[model samples]
Target: MTITELAKQWQTVIHHKPPIEKDPTSNDLLILIPGNPGLVNFYICYLDLIQQQFPNFEILCISHAGCDPNSYELFKFYGLKDQIVSKYEIIKKFVMDNEYSTKYNLYFLSHSVGCYINQRMVKLLLDDMSLVSHVDIKYVGLICPTIKDISKSVSGVRITKLFNYTPIITVLSILSSVLTRLLSDNYLLGIIEHYHIIKKPALVDFVSQLNYTNSTLGALNIVSKSHIVKQVLTLACEEMKLINEEKDINDWFFHDLGSKVKVWVYFADSDHWVNDKTRDELIKDYYDEDNHNNIRFELGKSDDGITHSFCIDKSVEFARITTNAIRRLN
Candidate 1:
């Protein structure tokens, strides 16, 4: 289907392949939640790889509200709580409206800030059994999760330091928009390829098809707005600190989700956004020593030149790693 056809109200996109049969297990779905600048098209390459691995699963990618430049007005209301609540509501509505809970096993795949949002969504599902009783959530994958001390992380420090200057970010945003408009898609693809931002030649076509200007603007807005960025960083730090407490760690990890749901967390060894310190802390605090059955962690190779945004550039390697993790879950 075309990008326009996939686009839905509130800047959401749902991509699904037609089911081959009426069986619930055969019609299982994978829902993707992207990080900041949450452009659904940004994940096209990653989703394509996943579809190749599991052809039976339908995929849905939801962009954050106001991520689209055309709906920039929604930015005013895009607070932390608002984002989580809206995402939760959107997922609930989609599942209920399509009767997916009765016919499909749902899987969640989240990246960066989406991991935090997905945790909250899972907490909500656990809290209200009535909402998720019929739903079969098979697995959850969190890639490059920024779950703690984000402001202190290498990438966060670099990004926050640069974006601390409002005028600079604003100017950069405008310049980016202008450049995106001026450059031909081929030229842009060539530039990205030269920098190795997109290693897979096949993915260049999909990247070129996206609205670069809009995506850039959305990303810039997130970094430039001090209040929004501060709020998110603060929330993550607080949650991490809370989880570190001995009493809360178990509930934070398990939350009565039971044995059926499997969670896999993939961390990059050299990820500046979520560094070794944070990753180690999470493992120390939440890694279950007793059973160690449902949760697992896989670390990426630092020498592989994988960045925190591996999904965008290292699509093929990222897919292989994620596919291996999925297989381990089964």
Candidate 2:
């Protein structure tokens, strides 16, 4: 699938438009808000699969600001809220430029922290009296989300301890900047493939499953050219501060957007980022069939072997699961 990209510096939003000859009929828009380290480079295959599934819908993704190195600027930070607003503005501009005045479905396909951004984007887009309300948020597919109480999760606890206590973000940013200057892309790729550095067996499994594809290379390329470590961790620290609350999610989405939008969340069999108990509690407390009939949850089995960072090797499988969920949405 050839992706048509609108690139501005490293900040890029890629889209797959059905061949003009095919002349797509559906006016739906599906926007993919990528996980933190918010580069859309990791999701080429995922978007391709989704485009194949819904040939009519336009599939688009924007890389999070400060994460892209293609036009490297000093590593600055855009917190989680900024990311949400940025995406909303981009989507809104696209809709306005295209003059999509008639009501149409807006489906949000997001991973990890992007889920939080997705929900917020939906709220913002819906509530915006300025935009004419042509874009109705129809569905939100949250994959391995970190929407609430992340500080309580295992990974969240570790990250909170590290970020709060240590100056790791600054130190690592300087270190990564130096390393990028010293190292070659090929060298970095070798290290990534060989697990020469911090080799978490769980994460490398994504690279192991998929050979050195563009996704893997792009992941390394960003690190080599940009000090995104600071940007990533900076946003992460803010996420720890802001995303600890979930009642807000219940207040806005389950109550305000209930039935008007369908929400599907897929959970990893075991995710350090999302607590299992919290996941269960969310299902039990909020999912009253009479009230929140628009919400549905999918759980991965222990042997399913899909990780939270599903964009790497598991992109195909995750895409299949997500597209399947989209098919079921009203």
- Please name the candidate that would achieve the greatest lDDT relative to the true structure: 2
Model 1 over residues 1-330: C-alpha lDDT tens digits?
Answer: 334432434444344554433455455778888876565655766776777788777777777644543443322435445556656666666566564435457888999878777777766655656665545678888888876677667766665665554545346445555655677555665565466443444444554334332333334444444333433344343333332223352356454453457888888878777767878887776677554568887777868756677655566667778888888886
The clash count of every prediction, one per candidate, is: 0, 0
Best by TM-score: 2
Which residue runs does candidate 2 get wrong by more than 4 Å?
1-25, 99-104, 196-212, 291-293
Residue 307 in candidate 1, Cα distance off native in Å? 2.7
TM-score of 1: 0.74
Model 1, runs deviating above 4 Å: 1-9, 18-26, 69-77, 99-103, 176-251, 254-260, 303-305
Model 1 root-mean-square deviation: 5.9
Candidate 2 lDDT by residue in tens digits, 12-116: 455445422233344677788888878777787678777777776776788786666665555556777778777777777677656433655678888888888
Give lDDT: candidate 1, residue 125.
59
Compute the lDDT of residue 313 as modeled in candidate 2.
Answer: 64
In candidate 1, which residue pairs get closer than 3 Å at backbone N, Cα or C atoms, i.e. clash?
A: none
